[model samples]
Target: MLVISYDLEVFTPPCSPGALTFSAIARLQGNIAPALPYLNAVLPNAVYNPGAPALVWKDGRRHVVFHADHLAVSNLEDRNAAVEQVERLVRLVNETWQERGQIEPSYAVRQRPTPMMLYKLLPGTNCRECGQATCWNFALKLGAGQVTVADCRPLADPIYADRRAQLLASVIEDQFV
Candidate 1:
Protein backbone atom coordinates (compact mmCIF):
# COMPACT_ATOMS: atom_id res chain seq x y z
CA MET A 1 0.00 0.00 0.00
CA LEU A 2 1.22 3.50 -0.83
CA VAL A 3 -0.01 4.97 2.46
CA ILE A 4 0.12 2.30 5.10
CA SER A 5 0.71 4.80 7.89
CA TYR A 6 -0.02 8.49 8.38
CA ASP A 7 -0.28 11.17 11.05
CA LEU A 8 -3.49 13.23 10.79
CA GLU A 9 -3.95 16.84 11.81
CA VAL A 10 -7.34 18.56 11.65
CA PHE A 11 -8.12 22.17 12.39
CA THR A 12 -10.08 25.26 11.34
CA PRO A 13 -8.62 27.21 8.47
CA PRO A 14 -6.35 29.96 9.69
CA CYS A 15 -7.63 32.39 7.07
CA SER A 16 -11.23 31.69 8.05
CA PRO A 17 -11.09 31.80 11.81
CA GLY A 18 -14.32 30.80 13.55
CA ALA A 19 -15.65 29.43 10.28
CA LEU A 20 -17.62 26.24 10.62
CA THR A 21 -15.55 24.45 8.04
CA PHE A 22 -12.56 22.26 8.87
CA SER A 23 -9.38 21.22 7.09
CA ALA A 24 -7.18 18.19 7.53
CA ILE A 25 -3.72 17.04 6.59
CA ALA A 26 -2.30 13.55 6.59
CA ARG A 27 1.47 13.31 6.85
CA LEU A 28 2.34 10.14 5.06
CA GLN A 29 5.25 7.89 5.94
CA GLY A 30 6.21 7.42 2.28
CA ASN A 31 6.49 9.53 -0.82
CA ILE A 32 3.57 9.45 -3.23
CA ALA A 33 5.03 11.52 -6.06
CA PRO A 34 5.06 8.61 -8.47
CA ALA A 35 1.34 7.99 -8.07
CA LEU A 36 0.26 11.56 -8.88
CA PRO A 37 0.26 11.14 -12.65
CA TYR A 38 -1.90 8.06 -12.35
CA LEU A 39 -4.28 9.99 -10.09
CA ASN A 40 -4.38 12.86 -12.56
CA ALA A 41 -5.32 10.43 -15.30
CA VAL A 42 -8.18 8.91 -13.29
CA LEU A 43 -9.56 12.03 -11.64
CA PRO A 44 -11.70 14.19 -13.90
CA ASN A 45 -11.34 17.95 -13.38
CA ALA A 46 -8.14 17.43 -11.37
CA VAL A 47 -5.39 20.03 -11.62
CA TYR A 48 -1.97 18.43 -11.62
CA ASN A 49 1.36 20.22 -11.33
CA PRO A 50 4.24 17.97 -12.21
CA GLY A 51 6.78 20.61 -11.21
CA ALA A 52 5.34 20.78 -7.74
CA PRO A 53 4.71 17.06 -7.73
CA ALA A 54 1.21 17.75 -6.51
CA LEU A 55 -2.32 16.99 -7.66
CA VAL A 56 -5.33 19.10 -6.71
CA TRP A 57 -8.83 17.68 -6.99
CA LYS A 58 -12.36 18.38 -5.87
CA ASP A 59 -14.15 15.62 -4.03
CA GLY A 60 -17.77 16.70 -3.92
CA ARG A 61 -17.63 20.05 -2.03
CA ARG A 62 -14.20 19.43 -0.57
CA HIS A 63 -10.86 20.57 -1.97
CA VAL A 64 -8.14 17.92 -1.87
CA VAL A 65 -4.43 18.22 -2.55
CA PHE A 66 -2.07 15.27 -2.85
CA HIS A 67 1.61 15.94 -2.38
CA ALA A 68 4.69 13.79 -2.13
CA ASP A 69 4.68 13.57 1.64
CA HIS A 70 1.13 14.39 2.63
CA LEU A 71 -2.51 14.78 1.64
CA ALA A 72 -4.60 17.83 2.47
CA VAL A 73 -8.36 18.23 2.40
CA SER A 74 -10.42 21.34 3.15
CA ASN A 75 -14.03 22.49 3.47
CA LEU A 76 -15.04 19.64 5.70
CA GLU A 77 -17.92 19.72 8.23
CA ASP A 78 -16.22 18.39 11.37
CA ARG A 79 -13.35 16.44 12.82
CA ASN A 80 -15.04 13.13 12.16
CA ALA A 81 -15.71 14.13 8.59
CA ALA A 82 -12.11 15.18 8.16
CA VAL A 83 -10.90 11.85 9.51
CA GLU A 84 -13.24 10.00 7.20
CA GLN A 85 -12.05 12.01 4.23
CA VAL A 86 -8.40 11.38 5.02
CA GLU A 87 -9.06 7.67 5.39
CA ARG A 88 -10.86 7.64 2.10
CA LEU A 89 -7.98 9.46 0.41
CA VAL A 90 -5.45 7.03 1.82
CA ARG A 91 -7.48 4.10 0.53
CA LEU A 92 -7.78 5.76 -2.84
CA VAL A 93 -4.02 6.21 -3.05
CA ASN A 94 -3.37 2.60 -2.14
CA GLU A 95 -5.95 1.34 -4.63
CA THR A 96 -4.66 3.61 -7.35
CA TRP A 97 -1.10 2.46 -6.69
CA GLN A 98 -2.17 -1.16 -6.93
CA GLU A 99 -4.03 -0.55 -10.17
CA ARG A 100 -1.45 1.81 -11.68
CA GLY A 101 -0.41 -0.76 -14.27
CA GLN A 102 -3.92 -0.92 -15.69
CA ILE A 103 -4.22 2.87 -15.89
CA GLU A 104 -2.41 5.27 -18.16
CA PRO A 105 -0.54 7.95 -16.20
CA SER A 106 -1.08 11.51 -17.46
CA TYR A 107 1.35 14.39 -17.07
CA ALA A 108 -0.81 17.02 -18.74
CA VAL A 109 -1.97 19.83 -16.49
CA ARG A 110 -5.55 21.14 -16.62
CA GLN A 111 -6.73 24.58 -15.63
CA ARG A 112 -10.05 25.13 -13.92
CA PRO A 113 -12.48 27.32 -15.85
CA THR A 114 -12.92 30.87 -14.60
CA PRO A 115 -16.29 32.15 -13.41
CA MET A 116 -16.45 34.76 -16.16
CA MET A 117 -15.71 32.13 -18.78
CA LEU A 118 -18.46 29.90 -17.44
CA TYR A 119 -20.92 32.80 -17.09
CA LYS A 120 -20.51 33.79 -20.72
CA LEU A 121 -21.56 30.31 -21.75
CA LEU A 122 -24.55 30.18 -19.41
CA PRO A 123 -28.08 30.87 -20.67
CA GLY A 124 -28.20 34.01 -18.45
CA THR A 125 -31.95 33.57 -17.93
CA ASN A 126 -31.57 33.82 -14.12
CA CYS A 127 -33.55 30.60 -13.84
CA ARG A 128 -33.91 29.15 -10.32
CA GLU A 129 -34.23 25.60 -11.57
CA CYS A 130 -30.67 24.94 -10.44
CA GLY A 131 -31.61 26.09 -6.92
CA GLN A 132 -29.29 29.06 -7.16
CA ALA A 133 -30.29 32.73 -7.01
CA THR A 134 -28.92 33.62 -10.45
CA CYS A 135 -27.10 32.26 -13.45
CA TRP A 136 -24.00 34.17 -12.37
CA ASN A 137 -24.10 32.44 -9.03
CA PHE A 138 -24.40 29.12 -10.80
CA ALA A 139 -21.39 29.98 -12.90
CA LEU A 140 -19.39 30.77 -9.81
CA LYS A 141 -20.35 27.45 -8.26
CA LEU A 142 -19.61 25.62 -11.49
CA GLY A 143 -16.15 27.18 -11.64
CA ALA A 144 -15.50 26.11 -8.08
CA GLY A 145 -16.45 22.51 -8.95
CA GLN A 146 -19.42 22.74 -6.59
CA VAL A 147 -21.95 22.33 -9.40
CA THR A 148 -21.97 20.67 -12.83
CA VAL A 149 -23.11 21.97 -16.21
CA ALA A 150 -25.99 19.52 -16.02
CA ASP A 151 -27.33 21.46 -13.01
CA CYS A 152 -28.31 24.28 -15.34
CA ARG A 153 -31.61 22.95 -16.56
CA PRO A 154 -32.01 25.59 -19.26
CA LEU A 155 -28.85 24.27 -20.90
CA ALA A 156 -30.79 21.10 -21.66
CA ASP A 157 -33.17 23.01 -23.93
CA PRO A 158 -32.63 22.45 -27.62
CA ILE A 159 -32.22 26.19 -28.16
CA TYR A 160 -29.16 26.16 -25.89
CA ALA A 161 -27.69 23.02 -27.41
CA ASP A 162 -24.75 24.83 -28.93
CA ARG A 163 -23.87 26.56 -25.70
CA ARG A 164 -24.18 23.29 -23.83
CA ALA A 165 -21.91 21.64 -26.32
CA GLN A 166 -19.39 24.43 -25.95
CA LEU A 167 -19.41 24.13 -22.19
CA LEU A 168 -18.96 20.37 -22.33
CA ALA A 169 -16.15 20.66 -24.82
CA SER A 170 -14.33 23.60 -23.28
CA VAL A 171 -14.74 23.49 -19.51
CA ILE A 172 -17.14 21.01 -18.01
CA GLU A 173 -15.77 17.58 -17.08
CA ASP A 174 -17.20 14.77 -19.12
CA GLN A 175 -18.76 12.68 -16.36
CA PHE A 176 -20.24 10.37 -18.96
CA VAL A 177 -16.82 9.65 -20.39
Candidate 2:
Protein backbone atom coordinates (compact mmCIF):
# COMPACT_ATOMS: atom_id res chain seq x y z
CA MET A 1 0.00 0.00 0.00
CA LEU A 2 1.32 3.44 -0.97
CA VAL A 3 -0.40 5.11 1.96
CA ILE A 4 -0.35 3.30 5.27
CA SER A 5 -0.16 6.13 7.79
CA TYR A 6 -0.37 9.90 8.06
CA ASP A 7 -0.67 12.89 10.38
CA LEU A 8 -3.93 14.77 10.02
CA GLU A 9 -4.37 18.52 10.23
CA VAL A 10 -7.92 19.84 10.32
CA PHE A 11 -8.96 23.47 10.26
CA THR A 12 -11.76 25.82 9.38
CA PRO A 13 -11.86 26.88 5.77
CA PRO A 14 -10.07 30.18 5.30
CA CYS A 15 -12.45 31.30 2.57
CA SER A 16 -15.30 31.27 5.07
CA PRO A 17 -14.03 31.94 8.55
CA GLY A 18 -15.90 30.11 11.34
CA ALA A 19 -18.03 28.44 8.73
CA LEU A 20 -19.43 25.02 9.50
CA THR A 21 -17.36 23.39 6.75
CA PHE A 22 -13.76 22.34 7.45
CA SER A 23 -10.69 21.21 5.47
CA ALA A 24 -8.00 18.68 6.21
CA ILE A 25 -4.55 17.69 5.02
CA ALA A 26 -2.85 14.36 5.53
CA ARG A 27 0.94 14.23 5.63
CA LEU A 28 1.59 10.79 4.21
CA GLN A 29 4.42 8.40 4.95
CA GLY A 30 4.83 7.20 1.32
CA ASN A 31 4.94 9.01 -1.98
CA ILE A 32 2.28 8.08 -4.53
CA ALA A 33 3.79 10.06 -7.41
CA PRO A 34 4.36 6.96 -9.48
CA ALA A 35 0.66 6.10 -9.31
CA LEU A 36 -0.63 9.53 -10.37
CA PRO A 37 -0.62 8.96 -14.11
CA TYR A 38 -2.51 5.74 -13.65
CA LEU A 39 -4.97 7.55 -11.43
CA ASN A 40 -5.32 10.28 -14.05
CA ALA A 41 -6.25 7.59 -16.56
CA VAL A 42 -8.83 5.89 -14.36
CA LEU A 43 -10.42 8.78 -12.50
CA PRO A 44 -13.14 10.50 -14.49
CA ASN A 45 -12.95 14.30 -14.61
CA ALA A 46 -9.77 14.27 -12.54
CA VAL A 47 -7.44 17.17 -13.26
CA TYR A 48 -3.89 15.92 -13.35
CA ASN A 49 -0.91 18.25 -13.37
CA PRO A 50 2.23 16.68 -14.74
CA GLY A 51 4.21 19.66 -13.56
CA ALA A 52 2.94 19.47 -9.97
CA PRO A 53 2.73 15.69 -10.27
CA ALA A 54 -0.61 15.95 -8.56
CA LEU A 55 -4.22 15.01 -9.23
CA VAL A 56 -7.31 16.88 -8.05
CA TRP A 57 -11.05 16.19 -8.23
CA LYS A 58 -14.33 17.47 -6.90
CA ASP A 59 -16.87 15.04 -5.48
CA GLY A 60 -20.01 17.11 -5.21
CA ARG A 61 -19.09 20.08 -2.94
CA ARG A 62 -15.95 18.41 -1.66
CA HIS A 63 -12.56 19.07 -3.25
CA VAL A 64 -9.86 16.42 -3.08
CA VAL A 65 -6.20 16.85 -4.00
CA PHE A 66 -3.43 14.25 -4.09
CA HIS A 67 0.26 15.11 -4.08
CA ALA A 68 3.38 12.97 -4.09
CA ASP A 69 3.24 12.27 -0.38
CA HIS A 70 0.16 14.07 0.84
CA LEU A 71 -3.58 14.37 0.38
CA ALA A 72 -5.88 17.29 1.12
CA VAL A 73 -9.66 17.55 1.18
CA SER A 74 -12.06 20.42 1.71
CA ASN A 75 -15.71 20.95 2.57
CA LEU A 76 -15.95 18.58 5.50
CA GLU A 77 -18.66 18.77 8.19
CA ASP A 78 -16.13 18.41 11.01
CA ARG A 79 -12.76 17.00 12.11
CA ASN A 80 -14.28 13.55 12.51
CA ALA A 81 -15.60 13.71 8.97
CA ALA A 82 -12.20 14.91 7.85
CA VAL A 83 -10.56 11.87 9.40
CA GLU A 84 -12.98 9.51 7.67
CA GLN A 85 -12.62 11.28 4.34
CA VAL A 86 -8.83 11.23 4.48
CA GLU A 87 -8.75 7.56 5.36
CA ARG A 88 -11.16 6.84 2.54
CA LEU A 89 -8.93 8.76 0.12
CA VAL A 90 -5.93 6.79 1.29
CA ARG A 91 -7.72 3.56 0.55
CA LEU A 92 -8.63 4.92 -2.88
CA VAL A 93 -4.99 5.70 -3.64
CA ASN A 94 -3.86 2.30 -2.48
CA GLU A 95 -6.53 0.57 -4.50
CA THR A 96 -5.64 2.53 -7.60
CA TRP A 97 -2.00 1.67 -7.12
CA GLN A 98 -2.83 -2.00 -6.93
CA GLU A 99 -4.94 -1.80 -10.08
CA ARG A 100 -2.30 0.09 -12.05
CA GLY A 101 -1.52 -2.89 -14.25
CA GLN A 102 -4.99 -2.74 -15.84
CA ILE A 103 -4.85 1.01 -16.48
CA GLU A 104 -2.99 3.07 -18.99
CA PRO A 105 -0.92 5.96 -17.60
CA SER A 106 -2.02 9.35 -18.94
CA TYR A 107 0.54 12.15 -19.08
CA ALA A 108 -1.49 14.36 -21.41
CA VAL A 109 -3.11 17.34 -19.73
CA ARG A 110 -6.80 17.95 -20.47
CA GLN A 111 -8.14 21.34 -19.46
CA ARG A 112 -11.42 21.52 -17.57
CA PRO A 113 -14.23 23.17 -19.48
CA THR A 114 -14.95 26.76 -18.44
CA PRO A 115 -18.31 27.78 -17.00
CA MET A 116 -19.01 30.13 -19.90
CA MET A 117 -18.28 27.37 -22.37
CA LEU A 118 -20.57 25.01 -20.54
CA TYR A 119 -23.29 27.66 -20.29
CA LYS A 120 -23.22 28.09 -24.07
CA LEU A 121 -24.09 24.43 -24.52
CA LEU A 122 -26.87 24.41 -21.92
CA PRO A 123 -30.55 24.85 -22.78
CA GLY A 124 -31.22 28.57 -22.46
CA THR A 125 -34.66 28.09 -20.88
CA ASN A 126 -34.61 28.71 -17.13
CA CYS A 127 -36.70 25.62 -16.63
CA ARG A 128 -35.46 25.02 -13.06
CA GLU A 129 -36.03 21.33 -13.71
CA CYS A 130 -32.62 20.70 -12.24
CA GLY A 131 -33.70 22.69 -9.17
CA GLN A 132 -31.32 25.55 -10.07
CA ALA A 133 -32.87 28.93 -10.74
CA THR A 134 -31.08 29.38 -14.08
CA CYS A 135 -29.16 27.47 -16.70
CA TRP A 136 -26.16 29.63 -15.88
CA ASN A 137 -26.31 28.45 -12.27
CA PHE A 138 -26.32 24.87 -13.51
CA ALA A 139 -23.34 25.62 -15.71
CA LEU A 140 -21.38 26.93 -12.75
CA LYS A 141 -22.07 23.79 -10.75
CA LEU A 142 -21.30 21.54 -13.71
CA GLY A 143 -18.01 23.30 -14.30
CA ALA A 144 -17.09 22.90 -10.66
CA GLY A 145 -18.01 19.16 -10.61
CA GLN A 146 -20.70 19.83 -8.01
CA VAL A 147 -23.32 18.41 -10.42
CA THR A 148 -23.31 16.05 -13.39
CA VAL A 149 -24.64 16.59 -16.88
CA ALA A 150 -27.46 14.18 -16.17
CA ASP A 151 -28.84 16.53 -13.53
CA CYS A 152 -29.79 18.99 -16.25
CA ARG A 153 -32.87 17.08 -17.37
CA PRO A 154 -33.57 19.38 -20.30
CA LEU A 155 -30.30 18.35 -21.88
CA ALA A 156 -31.74 14.88 -22.32
CA ASP A 157 -34.68 16.21 -24.36
CA PRO A 158 -34.47 15.26 -28.02
CA ILE A 159 -34.80 18.90 -29.07
CA TYR A 160 -31.44 19.61 -27.43
CA ALA A 161 -29.73 16.44 -28.60
CA ASP A 162 -27.02 18.24 -30.55
CA ARG A 163 -26.09 20.48 -27.64
CA ARG A 164 -26.24 17.51 -25.32
CA ALA A 165 -23.83 15.64 -27.52
CA GLN A 166 -21.41 18.54 -27.42
CA LEU A 167 -21.67 18.75 -23.63
CA LEU A 168 -21.12 15.05 -23.14
CA ALA A 169 -18.17 15.09 -25.50
CA SER A 170 -16.52 18.12 -23.89
CA VAL A 171 -17.65 19.06 -20.40
CA ILE A 172 -19.27 16.02 -18.78
CA GLU A 173 -17.19 13.60 -16.77
CA ASP A 174 -16.28 10.30 -18.44
CA GLN A 175 -17.91 8.26 -15.71
CA PHE A 176 -21.20 10.17 -15.82
CA VAL A 177 -21.84 9.83 -19.52
List lDDT for all candidates, in order: 0.81, 0.78
lDDT tens per residue, model 2, 64-169: 7778878888668998999899988888889999998888898867677799999999988999998999999999988877777768877767888677656654
Kindly give the number of clashing pairs for every candidate. 0, 0
Which pairs of residues clash in candidate 1, taking residues 3 or more apart in a chain or in different chains? Answer: none
Which sections of candidate 1 miss by over 4 Å? Answer: 111-177
Question: Who wins the TM-score comparison?
Answer: 1
The CA root-mean-square deviation of candidate 1, after full C-alpha superposition on the true structure, stands at 9.0
